[model samples]
Target: MERKALFFLDECRTVISTSIKKVLAKVGSKPVMRVNIGFSSIYVILAINAWTGEVVVSLAKRPNSESVKYFLRYFKRRVGSGRVYMVMDNYSPHKTKGTLEVCRRKGIHPVFTPPYSPELNMAEAVFKSLKNYMSNKIFYTIEDVKNCIKQFFKENKYRFNLNAITYLGLDKIEV
Candidate 1:
């Protein structure tokens, strides 16, 4: 599973957007660039099923223990009928009492990646795509970001290429 954070702005503002080519102007003419001032950051948690590459996402106002717990409940429901060997990063919220309790009840045994090793959590790759997709893009409101994200998740449903997860191998994840 992977988790990421995104900020959204209510107003659109960009003095100079992304440009593919350099301005061929006098040396004294420097271009000024600007982007909309972001207002709130939405904490998003993403979980992917390795076998099917199915992803589920949850958004919250804060990235705290309560939110993690909420996401865990969502994950448990998504996981359906079995125990899960959920690989995760060592985020503090992952170790919260509420989250642990949910895991215990839901039969989700979270295996933490070794400290300082963010790469071990495969969700980073998915989020990287999300970032690139949103980079330099303008959104008029938070709903715009939400709608875009919804579309992204929909189009990419079960679409993650999991060749990097060779150790476990494909079709070996579901229990």
Candidate 2:
């Protein structure tokens, strides 16, 4: 029997976007800085089940082989028994030997998306929707952003019910 597992794995960074209040200035609104040099971004490493809409999220300072290993280990523990195929873009970290070894130990098969083809990954659309949802709000700190992301997953994790799309000829997308 074939493995009944498929997940889209990727990392995302949420940066501060200027609020409408700054755009519609009344000529003396303290001139909101066009670029806030001190603001930091929150990094998110996530895996989403395209079929069921389940999401696993981790907050990180940066995305690298270590984080990928962490995610794979966590994922393995969460779903104890299954053969899994993780689809992701060709980020340098995902290709690292350390990350590959983690996947191997966790019984996960890594499927690489085509080069320069982020649109081919299902996680890309999910990230786009996440960005659109957060675009209007201004976050003061990275922790604040992390909280918002946690809240989003808490609310939407069970609400996904969509058909998976296939882009490449690989036998990766099957119900």
Candidate 3:
């Protein structure tokens, strides 16, 4: 059997406003955070190569079966011809018939993490890092948020370690 490349896939929603976090302020004085008044969100769909730390990201207005399938095709093109094993959460779009058909046609396999077990998916860590980077930072428009996300991934591309044995503790489990 040919060795398959491993990747962890996930989606994160980023808003144009900053995330609320505890801040150090003078007693009796509330910390002030200026935010955009209206709601604007973008979904970031990504796949992280478990061995190479290579990241592929796509932005969408919302995460749906069509968007997920599009990202899968994009990811397949980026990775070239190879059997891929993708670990992901059980998101509704990920299991849709269209998305599965795309996977089947592209030689991609989806392995879902157990319910309520986000930690099992290494992609969650990438999302957490992205959220932390975006926290306490105000963006006036969705484009600003999108640029920030793109910059974050470009700057920190080498920082991600998606090794399953290290992150999922697979090495400790006696097979």
Tens-place lDDT per residue, model 3, 1-175, is 6446999999999888778767799999978888665489999999988877778889999899999999999999988987899987988999999999999999999998888888877788899989998888889889999999999988986358667667877778886
For residues 39-114, what per-residue lDDT tens digits would candidate 1 score against the true structure?
Answer: 6455557776654556668767777788778887887776575667777777788888887888899887877777
Task: Pick out the ten consecutive residues of candidate 1 with the lowest summed lDDT.
Answer: 6-15
- Winning model by TM-score: 3
- Superposing every Cα of model 3 onto the true structure, what RMSD results? 2.4
List, residue by residue over 110-153, the lDDT tens digit for candidate 2: 99988998766767666776776665566777776777777777
Off by over 4 Å in 1: 1-34, 167-175
Every candidate's lDDT: 0.62, 0.74, 0.87
Alpha-carbon shift of residue 148 in model 3 (angstroms) = 0.7
Ordered by TM-score, highest first, the candidates read: 3, 2, 1
Q: How far is candidate 1 from the true structure (C-alpha RMSD, Å)?
A: 8.5
How high is the lDDT of residue 85 in model 3? 94
Q: How many pairs of residues collide in model 1?
A: 0
**Model 1 misses residue 137 by how many Å?**
1.1
Worst 10 residues of 3 by lDDT: 157-166
